[model samples]
Structures are given as structure tokens and as C-alpha cells.
Target: RGPQSQFTRAGVPAGFRSHPGSTHLNYMINFWSDRTPLHEAAFQGRLLHLRALIAQGFHVDTVTMDGVTPLHEACLGGRYACAKFLLDNGANAMAVSTDGATPLFNSCSSGSAACLKLILQHSASIHTTYQLASPIHEAAKKDHRECLELLLSRGAQIDLELPDVGTPLYSACMARAAACVEVLLYSGADVQIGCGPDSPLHAAVLGGGADVVHLLLDFGADGCRRNAEAKTPLDLSKPNSSVRAALLSRGPCSLSQLCRLRIRRSLGKSRLHRASSLFVPHSIKDFLLYQ
Candidate 1:
């Protein structure tokens, strides 16, 4: 029997299939009818119901037509218990949906650091192999600082770039995610790497993010850099906008700031966290670590 028959056996009401000419109804039917009892329980965070369905012989890894597993639904909805239960039952954490979203990506999408941590721990490799489904970028763009921080701590490339999304820092700037932008900078993200030819400075200004524009400049972003449009961020800013003022306020990098950048670069992204254990004075250590 086919997947359709399996679902029908699972008590999805009959007659959901649309007539040959009704593609829209067919799509709607497939979207809703393919969801099983396990999917609903996981999505709604009904732990007992999810456990009951699993006890009733529903496979933990069973997926919908779009490849959304019960684990995917749980993570997408930020249901940590449901996700944990599914994972313990041997659900595939690295399972990519038809849309290229992993359970980790959905966890980040929901801004649940707990779910994200669980998925990361279960999956041994968190490489950028799934570039289209970057959990770090999703976290940064959504301003989930704790989630992004946890990913960075676990060896996520600080400057991981995607074909469509650029680096996580750029994505954060474009989204006006100020807290996330600061987190990325402190984590040693490159300020210059933006989406293709666009500059993160340009993105910050366009997003009306005056504070983020300043943050980028503090991290050594070049204000003179032009995007594909041949416009500097200042040119894109409104004449009297705070973003314009922030862009214009940047001067030559201070000597202390330059020293901080150099030292942080020497430490590199992976060893940056160790700066906290350095033997320097508290203020100097804070300065060096961007605290």
C-alpha cells in the first residue's frame, strides 16, 4: 500500500482527494489530510497524546507529504518536551524536510534555545552542508541571541555564508536585529561579508537600524564600501535620518579600538571565549573581549 493508503488507515477521513480539475483543493487536501495524529500532538505540545500515539505504534520518524516529521513539528512549535521525547525515541535530528529545513532550523525559527540545544547535541555534525537551512542565520535574523550564542559556542562558523542569505551578521543587520548583531560582532563575525555585493552597513542603514550601523562601524566596517547599487550606506539613508547621522559619525578607527580588533583576531572566533580567562585587569579584559 502507498503512503496515501497508510494515512487513510490512520483514520484520515475518506474523500479528501480532489477531482482531477481541482488542483487548489488537491493541494489543500494534501497539506491537511497528510498530517497524522502524531503530527498534531507534537505540533500542539501535547506530550501525553504524543506518547500515546507512539505507544499505539506510530513511528516517531513518520513524515508528512512534505517530509515534516513529528520532531520537526515539535521543534517548529518550540515544544521542547515533545522534541526530547521524539529524539529519545530515535527520531532523526538531522532530517531535512522537503523544504530544506532541519529540526534545528525549526528550533531556531521558534527562538527556542532549549530545543535548538537538544537538536545540536543529538546531531554530531552541524556543518553548513545544509546552507539553505542555516540555523544560525535563522537565529540571528530573528534576534534570538541566546540561540545564536549557543550555536556559536558549539562551533557553528561565525561567518557562515549562504547563497541567498549572506553571513549571519549581515542577515541580523538586515533584519534590524540589534541584539543579534551585537552578539555576532562579539563572537568575531566579519562585518564586511554581506549578501553578495551588498554591505552589512548598507543593510543596516536600509533597515533603519541606526544602532546596528554604529555597531558595524565599531567592528571595523568600512563606511565607504558600496553595494551592487553603487550607493554607500550614507547615500541610501534619509537626509535627516538617525541612520544617516550614525553613518556620518564614524571617523578613523581609534588606536585602542584597532588594538582590540587585532587582539581579538589573534584569538580567532573559536578561542574568543577563552579571553574571559585571561589574566588582564577587568576593564582591559572587557575592552579586549568587547565586554
Candidate 2:
């Protein structure tokens, strides 16, 4: 028997089978309390079909075995139209997957800045995590700078720690996402923070990220600091690589850089946006505020 024959033989309601074409058959056969046709339509970005299913009484907040709602699917699929429609109809923006990933996390993973902005506008928590990984970490891992900036702009904590994920800076360094590392530094990520004993500098060296190494050093990372393994950033650098040379050539940061660092620290991450308005020269303001 075909896949369709098995469903009909099992006595699924006739109304469930009447939507016609492969769209209905593909999803209805897999139906359970966990996933309904509404989820399939949303996942598939079928706005008209999703509207019809909701009109037929499908619950907007319905979750699957994995706690995936239609909104999650829509975000994961980068289906902004479907996602906005679902949000407009009251899909829970804060619904988390069984793995602890929120729709915002899924949206960042999909690299849809529009989806992320929309979810943020709905007041979704930027701190939502999948286990220990926040959406910022996910954006860094995926090398999505726009998503990272959006999260940071809305006050996403740069230093949030998951059990083993460390801070977003460490995550970006390990991923060798140079642009992410730059943005994280400019947003005032603590270079001293680490996953275990490996600081962001160590993480950058181990990943062979030369530009990120320079960026971290420029942001005042302590390259001389040793990890639990007794390895400094130079020790972790690939043999004879430029990253090692850069670490070796560096001296203590200038007094001006130190003063800038202190100023940024005093203002704290939340007030960083106000640094530009200070009366200092643009160069000094840029240095102090991470502009």
C-alpha cells in the first residue's frame, strides 16, 4: 500500500484528508498532539494555508514532542511572512523548544535579522538559551554580525555564561568569527572571561584567528595570562604563525588606552551608547565608548 493508503485504512478523520495535494498528506500522516497541520503550514511558509488551518481551530501555541511551535518553525525556516502572521495572531514569542532554544534563538540561527528584530519588538528575552548557549552565542557561532549587533543594541548581555559555553566573546573566538570578535570587543566584552581557564585571547589563538588576536590585544586582553594548561596566547598560537608574532611584539598598552578602558568600564555596558555624546574628541570618544 502507498503512504496514503495506510492513513485512510487507519480511519483518520475524512476532514483531515480533504486539504488536497502533497502538502496535506506530507504532514497529516505524521500528526500527533505534538505537531498538527498548522505547524506544517507555518514550517512550509504557507500563509494562506496556515490562516485556513487556524480558522479551522488549530491552536496557535500547539507544541510538538520537541516543544516546537509553528512560530519556531517559521523562524527556523526564515519565513518572516509566516512568522509575523503567527505573531500577529498571538503566537507566544517566548515559547522555548524542548532543548531550551527560544524562537529568537531559532531566528538568529536562521540569520534573519528581520525575524530577530520582529521578535525583539515583541519583547522576547534576549537571554533565552539552548542549554548554556544564548542567542548572541548562536549568532557569533553562525557568524551573523547583524544579528549579533541587533542583540547587543537591545542590551543583550555580552558576558552571559552557560554551564560550558563561557561568554559570547569566547564563543566567537573559538569559532574564528573575526567580525563577531570585533563587534563583541567594541560592545565591551571582557577579554579576561573564558571557557574554564582559556580566555578569549587563548581561544582566538587556538582557533588560528590572527585578526581576532590583534583585535583582542587592541581591546587589552592579557596575552601573558596563563590558562589551566599553563598556555598563554602565544603558546596556543600555531607555530611560526603571524598570531604568535603579534602576541610576541606586543607591549603593555599605552596610558591613553588604559584610561579609555577604565572609562568604558566605569560607564558599564548598558550606558555605552551615550559615550558618543561626550565632549571629548571623536577619536577619544571612539576609543572610550567602543565606537
Candidate 3:
């Protein structure tokens, strides 16, 4: 007995044997899901049989086991036709898997400009927020400038914050994606937006992204700002002394010079307080002054 005979002889459910061709197709779908053929099909722009199978209900859009729909699979494989077929067959464009990933997110994350455009044209939300990672965040992380621009043009929120406090700008900065960072900043991402305990500057410092650090500084990122633990960007600097120096040496003044300026400012306030004390009437001063 072949595989089909065994499945039928084993008294599998009637649905299993009702349409053996569909059953075979379903099996192939699973195989394709694991080792995607949609990717190849999308690359080659041909998926006639796959489309017919989807039309015949062989390709279910609902999640099975991994919360991945056909759309997710198509996006993962970068198959634009498969994706279009899935979308036309009522596959939810905004469907997020158990991992909070959308087809658009995966497409952009994979750096497929064609797939990204297809999803965007089909009304995928550019500003769609996810639990941990987002399309823009993933694009920035991978330094896919074209994907990033595609998303931005579709109205992806440049400042969309992640659940763990990660932002697209922060991810771009951490990845040292200077082009992405420049695009995001030019598109109005808040440079001062802090993610969790680390600001974008802190992320750049920790990631040893000197160019990003400099770009952020030029955009008015305050290196002196501290995290939740009170660690400044300079404190976050690592083996890269160049990063440290670049961070410290902003605005024609070093961090040490800035510190001295702050100290002098404090001293000036103290002196003003002392002068106020000395000039007051004796009784009033005594009553107002606390020893």
C-alpha cells in the first residue's frame, strides 16, 4: 500500500479520504509551509496550481498550530502571487500570529520590496504595532533602507514604540544603520524618545554606532540624560573610546567641561543665596535663615 492507501486503510476520518487529491494537496501545503515553495513561486511569478488549490479550499487561511496563516507563509516565502491569492480568498491582512507578526511585517522584515509593496497596496497598516518587534523595527534592525522607505511612505509611524520599549529609531541606531536613522529622523522620529532604561543615544553607544551617535547628537540628542538606573550615555560606552569621546565631545564642549559649567552654575546660585543672606536686615535675616 502506498501512503494514500495506508491513510485510507487505517480508517482515517472520511474527510481525510473524501478528496484524496485535496488531502495530497494539504500534505503538500504543509510541506510547502515548512520549506516554502511560495518563495520560489513568488520569485518566479508563477503559482497557478497553488492558486487553484487555494480556490478549492485546500489552503486554509486560519492558523494551525503555529498561528501562521497562508498570508504569513506567503510573506515569509516572499511569494507575491501566493500572498495575493491568500488575500483575495479572505485571508486577514492584519492577522497576527501568536508571535505578534503580520504578513506585512514579515515581508518587510525579509527585505522583499516587491512583497512589501503588494501588502501595502492591499491595505496593510504601516503603523501597526506589535508586542515585541515591528516591520519598521525589523527593517531598521536589518538595515533595509528600501523596506524602511516603503513602510514610511505608507504612513508607518516612525516613532511607533514596541512593548519592551524598543523603537524603530532605537533599533536602527543600535544596528548602526546610519541611512535608516537618517531617514527616520528626517521623517520626524523623536530622537529623545527613550526605550526602557536606554535612550536612542544609549543604544548607539552600547552598539558602538559612532556615526549614529554623531547623527543623533546633531539632531539634538542629549548625551547627559540618564536612564532609569541613572547611567548616562557616556557611562553606557564600552570598548570604543571613539564613541565615548564623540559623545562627550559634543557642541564644542567636552563632558568634563559641561560638568564644570554645571558646577559653576551651582556655585553661582549658592553665591546668590549667600549674598541674599548678607544683605537682609539682621532680625529678618536671622528669622528667615535656618542654621
* Clashes per candidate (backbone, < 3 Å): 0, 1, 0
Q: Runs in model 3 with CA error above 4 Å?
A: 1-57, 60-62, 88-90, 252-291
* Model 2 lDDT on a 0 to 1 scale: 0.80
Model 3, position 34, has a per-residue lDDT of 32
Clashing pairs in 1: none
Looking at model 2, residue 102 earns an lDDT score of 86
Candidate 1, 162: how far from true, in Å? 1.6
- Best-matching candidate per TM-score: 1
User: Comparing candidate 1 with candidate 2, which one achieves the higher TM-score?
Assistant: 1
Models 1 onward score TM values of 0.85, 0.83, 0.68
- The TM-score-based order of candidates, best leading, equals 1, 2, 3
- Number of clashes found in candidate 1: 0
Predicted candidate 1 versus true structure: per-residue lDDT over 34-95, tens digit per residue: 66677778989999998977775566887666788889899999999999999999999988
> Every model's Cα RMSD, please?
6.6, 5.2, 14.1
Q: List ranges where model 2 is wrong by over 4 Å.
A: 1-37, 289-291
Candidate 3 lDDT over residue span 199-249, tens digit each? 899889878888889888865678788987899988888655889888767
